[model samples]
Target: MTRPETLQASSKPNYSSPDILRQFYQRLFPFRPLFQWLNHGPTPQPDFQNREFAFVLPGGAYIRYQSFLSADLFKKQCVQMTPERFEIGPQYSINPRDRKQLRKASSFRPVMKELVFDIDMTDYDSIRTCCSKAAICNKCWHFIIMAIKVVDTALREDFGFQHILWVYSGRRGAHAWISDKRAREMDDAKRKALAGYLVLAMSGEQGKKISIKRPLHPHVDRSLKVLNPYFQDEVLAEQDPWQSAEQAERLIRLLPDKDLTAALQKKWDSMPGRSSNQKWADIDAVAEAGHLSTLSAKQLVDVKQDIRLEYTYPRLDAEVSKKLNHLLKSPFVIHPGTGRVCVPIDTRHLDSFDPLGVPTVTALLQEIDEWESKSGNMSDEEKAKVQDWQKTSLKPYVEYFRGYVAGLLKEESKGKRSREEVAIEGLNGMEF
Candidate 1:
């Protein structure tokens, strides 16, 4: 019989060096805190015990149905295997390892997982002018910043969900994991409904006009308010998306009145290289000068408001959030492409969160070596006092993550019923 451990994927990214990966799994990874977060307590429970974990092995092999009884065992396997990365999936009704032994295949199915959102930079490529494709810069990062702020505000205030954690995807985007008991309990249908409510309906080509209807929903109104400040500076000033004539035409197409657009287009055509802010100002300037005859003041206000939303609103990839069993990359894993550790974004100090500044596995490992060299003569007693992870730049991120997980567990304890209790109540309603 072929050993399951020997199974390998035909293709996978092998970015992290084997020795470094082994050390990471051994010393750096916070297995206990992660286990506590998933398990919702210090001791083992169905949340962690029956949860599905899929690993991408270093030899380009993929493995699934991986579960552990405790954090230590999970860490032991990771260190032994030294897989490139692993993904977290929904908790099953039965232990994933034991699913095949069941009499009925249908008896084993996914039950619950954190509701997740994936916001990638590629989604904003059409609107952002600073960087496109796979490249990301601090300037272009404002798009992600805008997306996070808008989505986070809506999730908390509008939907009444707390315990939301925003994590950098380690390359050009971000992911949001909502661990609220209410959020975790949502079925695929409810999840889809919530995602639909969050996602803006801006379909078709880039230049196509977004059909923003009258009398916006309270959520839309509130989101527009959240996005208002960013649109002018981050979008209009920094991006200057409508500076070119071709792009300017795309802008003109979105405007309401023919007289207003004609006047603006002529003005833009005559004076080349006009900045987006100046062009925006020119709209009010021309309208005040009586260029717009047919469009009402009330209608114009509505149009401008819609334009703000069209430009700056969060463009969510709704598919990610509309499922119960979908697997998402675990929060703390190293991104294969960038080699950066996925770190939690502290919403309090959001403006200071820089993706490029995130510590890479290599860099973190080096920091450990440098610290060990400095403390070579320290007594064994003193050396054993502090965890090895605290010695590197990854310290702050891990500390922040552990703290976030603590808050979630505390809230989990306060809830009326445990995760399993609540899940068991509505078993028939949920799709596995």
Candidate 2:
């Protein structure tokens, strides 16, 4: 097993040195298989370690990954860059028992594929503009994640895809990358549209409903050709220059905005002129170069099935269950799984505090204010009684709110568990 500190040291990217790469690879071997677990999608192995796959460092140096774990540990380890062997501390050394325990914890999870859509963290200007302090606008983030889940769930239910993986991008948003064999062939356009729709959908409005009649944005179709494999087939079938022009004309006519039409024309002008054969290439060139046609075919059917069946009950059931699990784990609620107690403010209390009750809290407050305004007519005795009523009446509501907040604190305490403790508990009967 690799020591955590040694693994951490390897993250300081020194690509010029073969010695460094070799050291990093050696440190990563024991945990290399963990990538399979990290990934929730069909773990497609690249034929060669490609430049497209490299880690983005804080200073903009992308070190190509010879191995994933060492590379991940390297980024995390290097963040604290120190001259000593163990910058994080002496406690960072590897433990055989800990590695065994990590393996045991991971084994309980089902095998699934992993996929990533890592937007460059260095692209902070654009990311901040869109994400806006990580506070989502409209329904974009919700829709994207929901779309990913819907696709994953539909594939599992309708297409017998048993495994799906989802994770946060570790920055602005989340990634619902899928690995199911069925999703490999989806054309870039369809996938892109689904993702766009998920991201740009209306929040808290009727438009949020996913329906069969959901129309694809025209721009989504054009960009789809750029990303998905399935759309390549449609592009490939339209080999004639005149036919392609007609499709483009039709797509332009469908655009709702004149400004968008101008933008499309500008983009079209810059695109390289394709040879008759090249124009028809259905898949991304890099993916094609890697002989990934079979994977694309499998992904397309699954993707279509996912979009079409988004409204089905089994899919809804899965989604609700996932939400319920999250809700249960929240500190606001009494988490049944962890036996955590919740704040006891039964919202039912708010139901009865109406304007009509005499000697009632709200009513009494109104009466006291009115009497004070007309104090010229009243004796001192009336003012004294009103003061006494105000103090006595409001105390219970204030106390209830304080105790309600206290109960929430208790629930949070019960749910809190260290990572190591969580790792051990997830192992069930497995021995480390």
- Residue pairs whose backbone atoms clash in candidate 1: 8-61, 9-60, 9-61
Write down the lDDT of every candidate, Cα atoms only.
0.85, 0.30
- In terms of lDDT, the poorest run of 10 residues in model 1 is 1-10
- Span of ten consecutive residues with least summed lDDT in model 2: 83-92
TM match of model 2 to true structure? 0.25
Highest-lDDT candidate: 1
Put down candidate 1 lDDT per residue, 1-432, tens digits, no spaces. Answer: 111111134443344778878988888988988899889887899999999999998777989999999999999999999888898999999999999899999999888899999999888888778777877888778888888998898899888988898989988889999998889889999999999988887634556667766788888888888888899888898889899988787778788798999999889889998999999999999988888878887888888887888778888889999989898888888887777888889989998788888888888888988998999889989989979899998888889889998998888776735766777878967888
Error of 2 at 246 (Å): 41
